[model samples]
Target: MNFNLLHEIVLGFMVVLLLVAVAVIIERFIYYSYIERSRKRLLGLLAKGDEQAVLKETKGSSCPHARLIGGMLALKGLEKDAFESKVQALYLTQQAGVKRLLWMVDTTITLSPLLGLLGTILGIIDTFNALASQGVSDPQAVSQGIGTALFATAAGIGIAVVCLVFHNYFSERVERINEQLKVMALDQAGAVAGEGSGVRGGREPARIQPQAAAA
Candidate 1:
């Protein structure tokens, strides 16, 4: 087998992985942007404290944050333990949507470097084969072959690094969004409880401000 051909194959695989990673990144960005816009609208409704409006938006909306908050609102005034359990269950159910496409990015991150190394090895083997078949009278040819072989490793590492950075960024955003949902749910729940009990003398309603939840 031609070592150059093998090297090209490795690089080709790396390119595919990179493209996958980039696609995932772009998709996640669009998804998260939509989530952000939906969240802002929901927060605006929440700030108005119009129960009907909030319920209407939540009912018609597709955002997980909206649905999560809506579920919490629907379950308001329940016992703390039961409320928390239901909220947690809701969060777990919605997690699949929030984490979509992230696995592809992760797969690219894990495979890029290994594929690169494989390409490099194939290149080096080819180089040695050439030396065996023909005397190494031209030292420059050996050096060039070795250098070309290393491109596979470099390409692999480059792809992995790019994927790693985006993966971490998306992961962090997921964490922040998750935490925001949880906290906002709890805050709204508390606010509802406060309104129901008529205990306005002590603590104020902790309606989570939308601005505070910015990711």
Candidate 2:
């Protein structure tokens, strides 16, 4: 393939697109890794029965899921409903953070193919113009034009494919983390409720039962 043909097909913008795609991939890898590590640490703390310690540790970590769990843990002594509310609020905030930049990923995937198609059209038009100007007498000129046009289309489709794969992979990871968070919240709530009832080893007296329990 001629270097000029490759350049024409890529429309000078392919490099920029590739760089952006690579940056996205790297950013996602780092983000997910951080979240995963934070989650494991938080869960380990929870398993060890150090809920307060987990909350304090996560408060300084800036991890979204950790923050949510911290919020739930902070309400350990609150009523069940209040605790649930705080957990839900924190969960929402964490989810919003997790979803950040998702739209940009989607846009990048969508735009890549369109840009490729535009390059293809431009390449083909330039080739046809050359043919017309040269009276279509030279087969070499015609072949060059067609090659450039096709190259642009191929590059665009290739970029789009990469972006789409990344988008799907990252989206799945986000969903998995979100599900885990929901489970954690419910478990924390159950633990809090149990502790409040005198079901645990602690001998703290249970709160007054409802009037119906006395009847």
Best-fitting candidate, measured by TM-score?
1
Q: What is the lDDT of candidate 1?
A: 0.78
Question: After aligning candidate 2 to the native by TM-score, how far in Å is the CA of 108 from where it should be?
Answer: 2.2
lDDT of 2 by residue, 25-86 (tens): 88878988999998888777766776557757678776776776666556667776666566
Worst ten-residue run, lDDT, model 2?
Answer: 206-215
Positional deviation of 156 in candidate 2, in angstroms?
1.0
Which ten-residue region of model 1 has the weakest summed lDDT?
A: 194-203
In candidate 1, which residue ranges exceed 4 Å CA deviation?
73-81, 190-215
* Backbone clashes in model 1, listed as residue pairs: none
List where candidate 2 sits over 4 angstroms from the true fold: 1-10, 76-79, 192-215
lDDT tens digits, residues 76-170, model 1?
Answer: 77776676567667767677888888999999988999999999999999999999999798999999999988988898888888888998999
lDDT of 2 at 107: 76
lDDT score of residue 65 within candidate 1: 82
Clashes of 2: 0
